[model samples]
Target: MIKDLFLSGKTAIVTGGGGGIGRAIALGLSHAGANVLVNDLGVSVSGDSEARNPADTVVEEIEAQGGRASANHGSVAEAKATEKMVEQALDTFGSIDIVINNAGIIRMGEFPQMSRSDWEAVLRVNLQGSFYLSRAAAPHFRAQAGGAYLHLTSASGLIGSTSQANYAASKLGIVGLSRAIALDLGQHGVRSNCLAPSSTSRMTELTDNARKHLMSPEKYEALKRMRAASAPERIVPLIAYLVSDRARGINGQVFGARGNEIYLYGQHRPVRMMHAAEGWTPAQADERLPAGLGAFATPLEVITDVFTWPPA
Candidate 1:
């Protein structure tokens, strides 16, 4: 059982722990013996309107299961709010050992038609939000000499997804942020990593009736197949393991969870290096570069194109 994994005497702050994937991770962390501070803004997936406190419900569920948890309704988009989140976790659980930068909002739009407001909104919650919480936790982790950071990434950016350039950009930026954090804080014994989850979610906008008319029948049906086979619960095991002592040696990595399959993702590298020993004019370079690099050029493929087989 994942709950049997070792995480005793530790505290975790799960941002956006109100619902969906965030809620699942929070519960998983609690079951694994970590005191969880459930932080959420209680806003809709689109980052609009607050309702009743979503964090409280998760806290109640955790308590009912004989686990320790606290409710924190703070937006990670603000630095001050995230700072308060770290303080809340310390006050509630004593010492922080895990930080899950899972709180996020999506504003999907294609590049040409994407709005400035929409782009900013997506970046604020997905990229800046992760930065804020991680930044606030840095000093504490440094002092303690041991901490783990996991930020949620997405195929939308890691690979590609149609009509979601704004969302993709933010998610991809998170990959960079996680790597930088891992590098700077490794000396302090803080580990930072990223998880790209393939699961069904309330944010699955392809189900919208209006959008259904915009996509081809085959394309829409394909997306449905990919999401249907994957569940939010399937992601819990990997997360539980990553935050536990068992994964102490694992740091500065990107991982993925899809149904029963877990993946270690590869980072960017030079596929083929071209050193122009002597500089050439634009016309000369254009003539030779494409000829030399054409075979190695990456195809413009979406996530679905690559993960053609659904996880069983």
Candidate 2:
């Protein structure tokens, strides 16, 4: 049945294809019949320059399996570099049918002590990089009559996390950017969506370590069990489906992946309301809120709750 979702003759560019989720998706796309342009600067998690070329390894793996691919060593954080990445895909594959913005960096610090540089650095690579790549590839999508843009967000953004203010901000910004793109390019036959995957990767591993130290033994074990349920391959099918004709009817939505489970998130809307002919005094408002608005308030759902087993 997966072959029915084939992307034969289509060309796709996957940013951050060097390793982890990006690498898995790149290979998955290739297996589905898309010619891939694997772009990775081969940098470390913090964006430090490295001499190796991880992109080449992805290209080789695809080629070894009888798929077409090319490698690009460029940082998505820069506008010019991302532009060149698009050019490279066009030159090698002759067309760009899908663009997945998966390149990102994570810098964690407690909110109050978070440095200006740390915040800027995370935004530069995670938020700015997605913007640059999507902007550079939009015109091409328009010219082609149709395309798909899949940006990787995070559970941190969807829910909340501690000591990850910068990461959460960037991820949430990505979702906002994606929604706007979906609206702006819909008439042009372009589809844009955001994915909040719960897969284990370098990012999740780091968060797990932090939780281990911050949580009680039983709570940490529960966290560990939930993480064990997550793996990169569990989310790849969603990526494949999104970029296929099968998903043409879906756009501008945020979906989550955990093990074999796929979940949809509803848009934020007011759950309770209060009104007055004019306005109320602060004291009056405070007194009315608890009986009215506060009565409907619910606790924020934790990760364990979201990914819990036995289906509720």
Candidate 3:
């Protein structure tokens, strides 16, 4: 099923396709019979400007395998650059059917110690970039009556994070964005979904701050095991599948992939309900709410706490 060519005749724009999971998804999508536009700024995971643009290398690899592909060296942080990406895809492939928001950067800081610039920088690329790409393609998608968006979010966004406040905020913001897009555009046959993937990539590398302050010995060891067991390739197939025609019925949901395991994230809903028939004052409200509802409150869990065992 993973090797099915269900995406034949589609065109996909894969941002951050230079390396890691982004590269893997681009290659996989192309092999599924889609024309791919591999876009990468060639900057490090930190989002610094660099001399090289690695998009071309991935394009070369796709071409070597007898696939149709092109390269774009634009930064997703800029709206105009993302617009140009859509233009390039349309010019080369005739139409854009899929947009993969895989380009993101992480800056480490605890809540109190986080700098404003660091927070804004991460959101600019990770959250706003997703907006730019999706917005740029939306008109075309509307005109064509169909399209798909696959945003690569993270467990840090869904669950609690370990001193990655900026990164977590951006990733969680993406979930909200995806839900909005799915609701606003689903009538037009457009679909939007989020993939919270675990992988051994540059973003997953443990930071020194986390090493020193954020973790106990147990958590530190657990994180190391997670990074070692999850590979970027294992997360790619689900991403590719989410943006293909085969997944047309699925929309507005968050899914996860780690190792060979895939699972759905529970969306928010009320777990308990309490009614005060007498319309109690503030004093009585406190007495009834906590005693009745506190027991049902969800525990604060990190990715590791929920996934106690290593994935196969």
**Per-prediction tally of clashes:** 0, 0, 0
Determine the backbone clash count of candidate 3.
Answer: 0
The parts of candidate 2 lying over 4 Å away from their true place are 1-5, 298-302, 310-312
Which residue pairs show backbone clashes in model 2? none
In the range 68-150, model 1's lDDT, one tens digit per residue, is 99999888999999999999888877899999999888766657988999989999999999999999999999998989999
lDDT of 2 by residue, 191-292 (tens): 999998877677778777876676778777767676677778778888988988778889899988777888887767789888877789898888887888
Residue by residue across 226-275, what tens digits does model 3's lDDT show?
A: 77777887787787688877789999999998888899998888888887
Cα TM-score of candidate 2: 0.95
Candidate 1 ranges with C-alpha deviation above 4 Å:
205-216
True-vs-predicted CA distance for residue 202, candidate 3, Å: 0.6
Worst 10 residues of 2 by lDDT: 303-312
Candidate 2: lDDT of 191?
A: 94
Q: What is the lDDT of candidate 1?
A: 0.86
Q: TM-score of each candidate? A: 0.95, 0.95, 0.94
The superposed Cα distance between candidate 3 and the true structure at residue 163, in angstroms, equals 1.5
